[model samples]
Each structure stands twice: as structure tokens, then as C-alpha cells.
Target: MLTATKMFMIVFTLLSIIKSVTLSACDEQEILDISDGELLPNGDVVFDGVVYENRDYFINNVTGIKTACPKLVINKCCPFGTGYKTRQCVNITDSFDAPVWDRYKLIEGARAREMFRFRIGKINCTRPYARVLVSQIGQLDWSDNWHLKSDGKLFVELDSSIPPWTVQPPDKYCIDTFVYEDQDGKTHTRLDALACFLDETPPNHFEVRSTCMLLSCAFILITVAVYAWLPELRNMHGRVLMAYLLCLFVGFILMASMQIMLTIDNITPHICVVLTIVIYFALESAFFWLNVMSFDIWWTFSGKGGMTSKKMSKRFCAYSLYAFGVPTILTIILTSLEFSGLPPHPLLPMVRYQGCFLFGRSKLLYLYGPMFFLCLANIVFFIMTALRIARIKHETEMLKSKESAMHDQHRKDKQRLLLYLKLFTVMGINWILEVISALYPDADYIWCFTDVYNVLIGVTIFIIFVCKRKIFRLIKKRIKENFTNSKNNSEELKYKRTIPTRLCEDSQHQRGSVETIRTTIGMENGVTAEANTTIL
Candidate 1:
């Protein structure tokens, strides 16, 4: 009663059953039994679970198969231990229903089983067989920095000592490889299982940082605006301060936006690299402008005749060139090195490889290196200026000259220098913390402090400059002068209007009298001698 299809199905089932039975037998005893120490036809010997390279390379003769052999034969055994070998060459016959991970298909499946076993309270540290070799990715190698914490979580500490590229988060998942060993203490080279690192940061980390940065940027803009609006703050020193604050504002805003974009995954690698370059340029320019301020202060006290140089405009131009030009050159060098196709090194500014912003060695070398020199130079300038100031003070006191305009000008310069010093100290401390955070990224307390400090930078500058009693007095005077001038202008305008009206009336009356006189003269001429006598 069976049709052709029915007969074919029955035949296929019988063949599959036979194949399964044969494979099961192979699984139980993979090698054919022979005399001890006997070599196979291919000149290889199977000893225990491992196949020796040659007849002489047996269990007794083998010293360290883990390191001595390059290629390893994977065996079906417990998952965890010291010497678990890769299953890259093993055929998948188990019905564990594992997902595929390219070359790690079998390894991933085994890892799933291991994880399941662990979650089900199957982890036993007491027994050698109880330990499981669990890793998610086979391609990744283990590092000494990777450690198992007491809470059973894998923790990796990435410091400046390690190359950043090595610790870069993988696109798919994280990995941790483990070596497995048998009860006899022989280490087996196991295929490393791959799992992803929990790359999730604190939930509000980016949001809070970006918020603080933006708040600082707003204060910076306010500071710049205040300086620009008040003429008293529009002098040479004020101009330099404004320039520095503007550059800092630009850097902060762009950096905050970049972080926000990164947090939302809205930015691409190309954009990230571009933004980083721009941010670097802005921050560098800001630092250079700060240096310019320091040098200018030093020059003022250094008895440099050029402090009142014939062309103050030319002096500003020179400062602009130094501040802007150097950053441009540095940026060009950074861009060139990035595209030069050089092999990845610790010093190379691998902006694109980092996904967003510079970090680790690249940041330390590129961002911090020049800044370090600039800061050092600034410190030197400050010291020299301080010495010059002390000398000037002593000379003035020795001269016994009354408070002249020159003395007052010197006093103002000293005050400006103090302001610059304060600014330098603030920024110097801020960047020092930044460097420390970059070196030890795991230090959460440092990061928190830096975030709070970032918010204070602009506010502190504003307080130092615009909130002074002298500045307030100048603002009040400027406002009062403006008001008084407007009042005078209104009164003068009314008086001029009254004078014009009165003069017009007087001129009209005079014209009428002249017309009357002309009429009388004409009548006199007509009447002649006879009419003149009658009128008299």
C-alpha cells in the first residue's frame, strides 16, 4: 500500500539511524586500539586524548605539550580548567542548539552550556573537573590585567601603560580566554570563549558632564560679552582676556556637543575625528592666548619700552599670530600623521581608531605635551614678572615719588598680572586633574571632581574680572555719563527750538516796518513840496 514517497522516506530514515549509531561509536572511541607506543600509518601516535606529533612524542616523553606543540587536537571534556583546547577543528555533532560566531560556532555553543551550568549553580572550585573553561570569543587573547573579581565579574583595568587599541571595545561582543588543565596537572591549550565587556557606562555620566560643560560655556560667553561691552575692559589686557575666553568657549561647546552626540550614537567616525581636531585647535589656541597674557604682563613690568610701543596694534597682531599660528601647525601635523598610514603605535594620534576624541597615550602626547611646555613657560614668565614687580616697587619706594600717573599705571598692571596668575592656577589645576584621570581612568572620584571643576571655570573667571569693585564702579560711571549726556542733549535741543521761533517773529516785524517806511517815502515823493508841508 506504500507509494513511492513513502518508500523513499523509510529508506532515508534507516540510513540516518545507521549514520547516527556510527557517529556515536566514533565519539566514544575516536582512535583505534593498538599496542602501546605504536605509531599510526601517518607517523603520529594517539596517547590518551591528545595525538602526539610522532611515535617518540608520547605522554612520558612530552615535557610541556601546552607550549611545545603549535597545533592542538580538541577533546570532549569539562569546560573549565587550566588547559582547555580550542574546538576550531572539531565537528559539531551535539544537539546543544548553539548560535554561530564564524569560526567559533562549536566554542560558542559550549560556552552557552557552560554559562547555563554556572547560572544553575554548577560552578565548583573544589574539584579539578568542576572548573569550566568559559570564553565567548576565540580570536581575542587574554591579558594579565583581566581579573576575576570577588563578585564573579570580569574586570579589565586599562591604564596608560597599555596600548589603547588593544583594549578597544569589539563591535560584536567581549572576550576572556582561559587555559584548562586535567587532574594530572597537564595544561591544555583551550579555545578561548568570547563574551562582550559590559561597555555600559553610568547612566547619567555623559548627560551630567555635558550639562556642566554647557553651563560653563554660557558663563564664558557672558564674560566675553561683558568685556566687549565696557570700554574700560576693552584695553589691551581686556582684549587678550576676551580672546582667551572666546576660544575656551568654542572648545567647551564643541566638546560638549561631541560628547552628547557620542552618547546618543548620533555621530559617525569621520565626524568624531573632525570634531576632535577642531576642539584640539580651539583649546590649544586658548592656552596660547593665556600664554600671551602672561608674556604681555611680563613685558609691561620688564621695562620693555614696547609696552607703550608706537603701534600697539602691531603688538596685538604679533600675539594673534603666535596664538593662532602654532595651533594651526600642530593641527596640520596631527592630520598628516593620522592619514599617513603609519602602523599603530602608542604615540600615534589614532583619532579615528578611538571612535571619539583623543585618549590614553595619544591624548597625553598630543594634547598634554605642548600644553605642558606652554604651562611651564607661563610659570617662568610669572616668576620673572613677579621679580620685576618687586624691583619696581623697591625703586619707587626708594625714589619717594608721590603717586604719579605712571605709578598708578604700574599698579594697574600688577593687578592685571594677579588676575592672570589666578587664571593660570585654575586652568593648570584643572588640566592636571585631567591628565591624572586619563592615566587612571578607573578613578571615579577624580572624574566627579573634574566635572564639578569644569562648571566653575567660567564662573570663577567672571567673578575675578567682572565682579570687582573697580569694574562695578566703572560700569556705574559709564551708565551715569551716558544718562547725563542724554539729559543735556534734550535741554539744548529745547532751547535751540525756542530761539529759532523768537528770531523768526522779530524778523517778520522788522520787514513790516520797512515796508511801511517805503510806502511813506513813495507818498512823499508823489505829493512833492505842497503835501510835505501839510504833513509836518
Candidate 2:
């Protein structure tokens, strides 16, 4: 009785009901398994209602474009003056974001979750090439240092010091890197996740830098030895030179340690904070003393109210205090600012980075500012000193035939003036150039030469002070004394032995002779015989 359309609709409805029932009964045992909510492959435990495996909330949540960074919640306070691991590998705009360069991608998404929760400024560098490993929530299994694999994927090796934790943070994170083809001029560096461990073998250039500093350290030691061995070189100039060398020695040593041992993760924490001060003291002392030296030479050449060497010698204590005290005050101010926990007034962003190395930004002003000015002063003084020397040269030439003594005196003055110029070149000018290189870090071309010069300045100092004829004379004198000392002692021994034997022979002849010889040997050596006569 119904139309054809009505008959077709009834048949279709019955078939749909049968298909729905069949699909619903497919997984009868596990429809809503409420015993455990869900088991995430990444080991995250979720108790909320949504059953079965769901990738949206865990894996895909973090794996998506970084535009959806999790809300930042400050759960802990980071202290200053300590070295910390580089947990926050940042890219742009004041947060740890992946670099947007190089159409590159991070390989493992799971370990990236662990990297994000890493705390800053928290490791001690007990060994070289060490790594700071992090663990899961429920177990003590650790994630070792990350490295670039042969195929360009960053592989974070997993090490288990204890049984693996059943639950862990949502794993899998990555940074997209942008690299450039070297053949083309458009260059770009893809700074990916910084390796958390100090490389056992640093890059080739780092080795050269290390070698340069080491060589300089050795040369500075030679200079120190020369100064210590030769008392004559302990004049005002020599003393200042020694102070500068000492500062560089320590500074370079710290620098070398940083180059060899530290990374973002394996920080040289609490101890490095104090050593940082020592490093500052070394640099500041060197700079302050170099300025004092330049001023002294300039005044000597000016000849108006200029103190003689004897007079300048009296100011050594005052100069020492000025050189050391000023730096101490600045260091104290910086330390207070660092721990204040307020907006970093001038500590620089490096304070937030690895501990103790770039501890503060104020160093640029408090440290480098004075250094720049001092270098400037030294340059002016060097010119003034040189001109004064030229005038003396002309005057001496005019009076050479007439006044032989004055001519010889002026010649000696000229030599001393020349030495000052060499010192200025080595200590003042070279350091100024090095500072300039630091200011413009992008200028790699200039850095190469300046780096070498700064590192080798100790060698220059040794050549100027220790390798000179005066130092040579003192060294030769010491050597001659060492060889002659034994001979002189042997001669004295021979004289004593022969004289004693001769006296003994004479003493046998008479009691008077024995008494006289006993008296010559002294009462301490005289022996009384039974015959009531002294025996020698």
C-alpha cells in the first residue's frame, strides 16, 4: 500500500541499526576501563575521565609550534654568584625558545620535556668533561648529555643509575635550526640545544687559545722568577711590572680552566663565585699599576717637580693600596647588587647564565671603563715621554763635545725613556686593543691578532724585563756565586785542617805551645790533660 520511497527508507533504517550494534560490541572488555584512567606511552599518569590512549594532551601538546609555550610559573629562586647548568637554551625575546633559523628540527621530542624543567645555576665541576643528568618523576633514571648524531639528529643518551621511573614528564621537545650554505654569502648559525657536557677535546681554535695562554703563563713565571731572584730589579718600575704579571697569571689560569672544563650544564658553582673575585682582582691590579707606571715615567721626563727614583720609591705602599683598594670596593658593590634579588641594576644578563664567569654586566663600566681611560692616559704619557726624550737627545747632541759627563747622563736617560715606550706598547697599548676586540665581538678578523697579542704579552714582558742586559747580569752573578760558593768553602776547610795539624805538632814540643795553641782554638775546643796543661 506504501509508495516506493517509503519502502526504501524502512529498509535503510534497519540496516543502520544492525551496523551500529556490531561496532559497539567490538571491544566489550575495555569499553571504559576505570581501574587506571590512561597509560601514556611517555609514562605520564592521567586520572581524568578520558579513557584509552590519547596523543592530544601529552605528545602533540608540546610538539606543536612553539607559539603555544606553557604559562611560565616561577616555582624556585635562582641565586647569584654561582655557576649553573644551561637548562634554559634560549633563542629570542627573553625566554627559552628554539632558534627559528635553519629549516632544521630536533629529533627526539621526549627528552625535550626534561630539558625545559632543568634548574639553572646548580652544578659543581668536580671533573673535566662531566655532564649533569636529570631524572624522571617516579624513578632515578637519568638523561645524559645531548650531542649531534651523524645524521644531524640530536641524541640525548639515557643512563640509568637506578631503576627507571614509571612516570616521567611529558617527553619530546625540539628546536628548529636555520643553517646556511657556505658557498653562498648569506651566513646563518643554527644554535640548537647547547651540549650539556664540556667537550673532552675542544675545537681546534680553542686549543690554540689555550696554548697561547699556557705559553704566556710560562713566560710570566720566568718574569716572576727573574724579579724574585734579582733584588736589584725590585725598583718602582720592577715592582709594578711584577704586580701586573701576577694579576695576568691568575686571570689567565682561571680563563684556561673555564675553557677546558665548564659548559652550560656542568657549572663550577659556589667556588667559582669567589674565584671570579680573584680574577677581577688580577685584571684590575694589572691595569691600575700600569697606569701608575706610565704616570711616573711621564713625570720624570717633564722634569718639573718630578720626584727622583729614590723619592718615587717611597710611594710604593700608596700605589699598592690604590691599585688593590679601588677594585675591592667595586667588587663589594657588585656582590651586593648580585644577591639583592631586585631588578638587575647592572649585573648584566650573563649573571643569569653560567655562574661566575660573566657574573655581572657592571664589569663593562667598573672594570673596562677605567681600563680604557687608563690606556688613553698611558698613550698620552707615552707621547709626552717620547717628545721629552727627543728634546734631551737634541740638547745632549749640542753639548756632546763640551760636556762629556752631561752627554753620558743624557744618553742613559734616553735609554730608560726608550724602555718606557716598550713597556707602554706591551702592557698598555696591547691591552687597550684587546678590550676593543671584546667590545666588538663580531669582528673576528681583528680578534685573531689581538687574542694572540694579549696571550703573548707575558712573553713580551719577559723579553723586556728578564731578557735585558741588566737581568742577564744579575742571573750571571747568581750562577757564578753558586759555582764559586763550594770552592770558597773548600778553601776555608783546607786552611782550617792544615793550621790545626801544624798547631798540634808544635803543641807536642812544649806545654807553653800547647797552652798557646789551645787559647787560639778557643776555650770551647781546649781539653785539660792529667799533666795540668791544656791540650789543643
TM-score top scorer: 1
- lDDT tens digits, residue span 1-536, model 2: 99999998787566545544533554545333223434556533333322111221222223331111121111111221112224432232222322111112334442322223222222333445443332221235322333433222334433321111111111222222323334566644332332234435333354566667788888898888889777777777678778877877888877666555443224444555666666776787777777777777777667756456776766777888888888788677756655666742443422432344442235466668777787888888878888887887677566456458756655665666677678767766666666666576446577578668856687787787777776788889988897799889999899988997888877777867766666655645553443334222
Every model: Cα RMSD to truth: 16.6, 19.3
Residue range 1-536, candidate 1, lDDT tens digits = 99999999898667546644543444333433323533557755544433443322212113322111222222223322222235222223223212222211122333332221121111223322223223322224443443222222333333321122233222222222224566799854433333233343325477888999999998899889878878877878888899999999999999899879867767777787889899999999999999999899998887767545446778888999999999999999999999899866777898876657888788999999999999999999999999988888887764345557777777778888889999999999899999999899767788789989999997898888889998889889988998999999999999998998899999999987776676688676785544544554
Model 2 residue 343 distance off true place after TM-score fit, in angstroms = 1.4
Model 2 superposed RMSD (Cα): 19.3
Query: How accurate locally is residue 34 in candidate 1, as Cα lDDT from 0 to 100?
Result: 26
On the 0 to 100 scale, the lDDT of residue 485 in model 1 is 97
Clash count, one per candidate: 29, 16
Q: Once model 1 is optimally superposed onto the true structure by TM-score, how far is the C-alpha of residue 252 displaced, in angstroms?
A: 0.8
